[model samples]
Target: MKYIKKYHKYIGLFGCLLIAISCFLPFIKYSILNINETNNFFNGDGKLVLAINIITILLILFNKDKTSLISTVSIVVILIQNILTINKDIISIGKLGYIHFSIGFYLLIAGIVICIVYPFLPKEKNIS
Candidate 1:
């Protein structure tokens, strides 16, 4: 449980950085290079990835007892979105596209693992 929480924290941090890069860099490249593929990647499913990143940030920020329910709900929504996107080919499979698919898959798996292990973690006792 401790390890899961630790990894989740670190992974979430990495996710933030990846989202920032993925959202901005390609768009900037497209503008400078006048490339259609870069623009297409950003304008298409990138929007969905950005939305998921926002939700993930919210979930991580509100992960304590008061917001645990919301965290769980957000995680579930993310997982469902991942499944649907993968099925619909919104998440592509290739050298150039594998990063997005990999991140989505890892996020879904990590969220589920965290949720499963969360309940077994030790709770704080109220001090009188």
Candidate 2:
């Protein structure tokens, strides 16, 4: 826990980096009888990732309590969006494999979790 508190910000930053990189990675791929396509631009969670990234910046700029609450809300929003997509089958990976999960989505999700956890870290104590 102490180590987590000590490095939570870094973790969050790494997550944000991952989100940015994920934007360029192959998010989904599809193939059909005569054509194939992929979505790497922002992918499925691009907008959400953008939101998380912005909120992460806010978390870093603000103090505790407020940051914590905002972080929690951000987490909720990401989860909600993920859930909604799952329930609605928004991506459509149909019989033709219209869409498929890619490395980008995994990286994006990892980054989001890390960012969300950062706000709950314990503040560093002054040894001096």
Candidate 3:
């Protein structure tokens, strides 16, 4: 249980870093091989993605009392975004889209897993 808790924390933190990169990579122009152009998406309403990422990070970091609530909300937002993107068929279903989709999907799954396993973790004793 302790090992699982530790790995979960690490994985969540790592995912947060990836989310940050995906959120902020746009707004800067740089040509790199295999990396798709993100500036176009960033120019539009895609900024909302960044906003959600920021909010999710904060909620996960400070959600001691409401972990399940926060996780549920985060998962729902990610899942909705993925569904909308797929349904609209806007972005090209290529390498970049795959990267984006996979990351979002993994984040949602991780949040769900963490929420489910959270109760199994050892609780901190309150010392008076």
Candidate 4:
């Protein structure tokens, strides 16, 4: 816990970096009519998510309470929006392969989870 508290900011920064990198990786994959298709951050609202993540990185660096809260809320909203739309947009056809969330999607969720949890971690104790 002590180590986490001391390095929470860096952890958050790492999460933000993961998010930024994930933006360029394949996010979703599905097959329709025997053809496979993959989508990345640039295809949908990914660019917006990336932009918000950049703001989150700045907020984490600044270490402002209110700003962090705002960024967390915004990230949650984006996550929810993506979850809802991904389900809605993918049309399931009989005999077609199932939709799969690729590496980028998981990485994105992981990063968001880290960011959301960082603010709640206990503060470091003073040894002196």
Candidate 5:
């Protein structure tokens, strides 16, 4: 807990970085069509996720106050919503091919989780 608090800002930054990168990676793939495409600009909700990550990054860089914490929580909510929506879309495509969630999806989840959790950690102890 102490370690996490001590480097909370950096941890958040890393999560933001992950979210940013995930936007460019393959979020989902249609095995039948061999479509291993990136999310974000092309398809899916990666663009919004990336946008939120950028906002979170700015908040983390500029302030560690309640607003930043609130934004992180909001981002997590948005991320989860996107996930569910995508799942629903996938189901709607039923039998279109073997749908496989690629690394980007997992990474985004991990990143959002990290971003949300760090805000609630106990403050670091001052050694000075």
Candidate 6:
């Protein structure tokens, strides 16, 4: 717990990095109409989510209050959108294998989770 409190900012920054990277990576893999295709976050409705995450990261970096409501709201919105996209049905008459989430989707979800939890972590004290 102490370690987490002390390193919370670093952890949050790492999470932000993950979120940024996920924006460019493949978000999902599916064959629409039997045509193999891959899509990244910006390729679809994920663009808004990406923008939200960017704003959230910026807020987190500059805001003194780690537990700011806006930060939480942004991450929550991103998470909700990712979950909805994952569950939404698409290409029903395609291959037997169901649509699978790519690494990007998982990364974004994980990053958002970390960001949400980081604020609750105890604030660190002066080390010097």
Best-fitting candidate, measured by lDDT? Answer: 4
Which predicted model would earn the best TM-score?
4
RMSD of 5: 3.1
Clash pairs (backbone) in predicted model 4: none
lDDT of 3 by residue, 1-128 (tens): 65655554454445555544444343323223455543423444336655665665565566442553464456456556656855554455433343334343444456445544444455445479
RMSD of each: 7.8, 3.7, 6.8, 2.6, 3.1, 3.1
Q: Rank the candidates by TM-score, best first.
A: 4, 6, 5, 2, 3, 1
Write the residue-wise lDDT of candidate 2 on 1-128 in tens digits.
Answer: 78876765566667667767877887656565557767773655666656666676666655443464465466557646765765455456456445467786677677666666666667566599
Candidate 5 per-residue lDDT over residues 49-82, each given as its tens digit = 6776677888888756345667667767776787
Which is superior by TM-score, 2 or 6? 6
Tens-digit lDDT string for candidate 6 (17-83): 7877887899888765666778788766566766766676676677544654466467667667666
Q: Give the alpha carbon lDDT tens digit for every residue of 92-122 in model 1.
A: 4333332234343444455445544444455
Candidates 2 and 4 compared by lDDT, better number: 4
Tell me how many residue pairs clash in candidate 6.
0
> What 10-residue stretch in candidate 1 is worst by lDDT?
27-36
C-alpha lDDT values of all predictions: 0.46, 0.63, 0.48, 0.77, 0.70, 0.71
TM-score of each: 0.38, 0.65, 0.42, 0.84, 0.74, 0.74
Q: What C-alpha lDDT, on a 0 to 100 scale, does residue 58 get in candidate 2?
A: 61
- Kindly list the per-residue Cα lDDT of model 4 for residues 6-108, writing each as its tens digit: 8878887887888888888998888777789898976677788778888888888777534675776786687688878777766545455667799998888
Better of 3 and 4 by TM-score: 4
What clash pairs does model 5 have? none
Off by over 4 Å in 6: 32-34, 65-69, 85-88, 91-97, 126-128
Q: After superposition, how far is residue 66 of candidate 2 from its true place, in Å?
A: 5.7
- Runs with alpha carbons beyond 4 Å of true place in candidate 5: 33-42, 125-128
What TM-score quantifies how close candidate 5 is to the native fold?
A: 0.74
Could you tell me how far off, in angstroms, the CA of residue 28 lies in candidate 5 after the best superposition? 0.7
Name model 1 segments beyond 4 Å from true: 1-67, 90-100
